[model samples]
Target: MNTKIYCLEQCFLPKNWELLLSAVKNVAGFCKESGKYDIPTLPVKLGHSLSKCAKVLRTKAIMEDNEDVKKSVEGFLKLYEDEWNERISVKARQTLYDAKFN
Candidate 1:
């Protein structure tokens, strides 16, 4: 009965579906690389890329009617949300900036 659960029941065109899938893959790849790298400023760069990809998935989800595509978008949203929640603080950002400029 939940609206969020029901939203995934819709369908989408094949081309749009493909695009959504590609965005999901790209986001996943960025996430993997972000976790793999230990460089101080790497998360910021990867997060930026992930955010862009998440935005694409979000936009596609709004216009897509396919249940599969909706599910994929939902998964990516959850994953990225968790990643963002653990984002580096301003202190970390300052450290990265100082490291680059100093």
Candidate 2:
């Protein structure tokens, strides 16, 4: 079953957005060239991963069943709903800025 990882419509802050946009651009190119891989929606999966990355950052993770692991991730994602939108907004602005420049 596919799970909605996180809704990032109204979260995200004003900092670190540029990094997110940059990563999205880089990852888009990488994923396109790399064999089989998911084509992530900009500011969507990118935001989800950002939120999850923050929680898992510098933390040790244990292996688990694949399905169970995906569920566990969704549970973790729900907890981050609070911060996702803010992060997305900020990243979007950065994307805007980069567009203005380049």
Candidate 3:
């Protein structure tokens, strides 16, 4: 995967699992590459950024081709579904409460 995948001005968290899986694959592939710095920081940086901005995300993206990068993305997907659901749940509750009381 090209490192330019991370050049987006906004987060890419598609609602569809397949697209999201493709993205996670890209990130995992990118993470496997050797960074110029002493430490491999892209994973953490990208993870934090996506987590911070993806709460209200609902968009689409073109899926990338399948690559050898698999294990980490699969692991993340297992946990990601739950985490994404929790964020959406919190947002929905807040919206409903605000609509009722505000």
Candidate 4:
């Protein structure tokens, strides 16, 4: 999925940086959620995908010499890291456990 989108963005959407950036940002946001029915690993899976997508987009941004898009991709990459790297609060951990097991 990341490779396909990257190819299309690179070959077809070269002048449409906003759309390309938006796609990554949308996925990045979605991957941050831990909704009622979401499994504990949901965010991790989506975050991994987001990381892959963002890395490719970052490379494309660099190739295009577009600092704004590059910066945005970097931000998304940071978000991807935070999705899994942040330590869970005790309260939040309880909530997640209940959601999955109860």
**Per-prediction TM-score, please?**
0.41, 0.27, 0.28, 0.46
Q: What shift in Å separates residue 67 of candidate 1 from its native position after superposition?
A: 2.4
- The clash number for model 4 is 0
lDDT of 1 at 31: 33
TM-score of the candidate numbered 1? 0.41
Candidate 4 at 14: error in angstroms? 22
Clashes of each: 4, 10, 0, 0
Cα error of candidate 3 at position 44, Å: 23
CA deviation > 4 Å runs, candidate 2: 1-41, 45-71, 97-102
Q: Tens digits of per-residue lDDT for model 1 on 1-102?
A: 111222222212222333433343343333343332225455456556655765666677668755566666566656555644353323336555666797
Residue pairs in steric clash, candidate 3?
none
Candidate 1, residue 44: how far the Cα is off, in Å: 1.2
lDDT tens digits by residue: candidate 2, 1-102? 222224442123223344444455565443334321233345566666666664452232233334444444444456446554554445455455655687
Name the weakest run of 10 consecutive residues (lDDT summed) in model 4: 83-92
Q: Which candidate gets the maximum TM-score versus the true structure?
A: 4
User: lDDT per model, in order?
Assistant: 0.47, 0.45, 0.39, 0.51
Model 2, residue 49: distance off in Å is 11
The alpha-carbon deviation from the true structure for residue 70 of candidate 2, after best TM-score superposition, in angstroms, is 7.1
Instruction: Specify the highest-lDDT model's number.
Output: 4
Please, what are the lDDT tens digits per residue for candidate 3 over residues 7-78?
332224222444443454454443224311222243345455565444322221113333222333443445
User: For model 2, what is the alpha-carbon lDDT of residue 6?
Assistant: 46
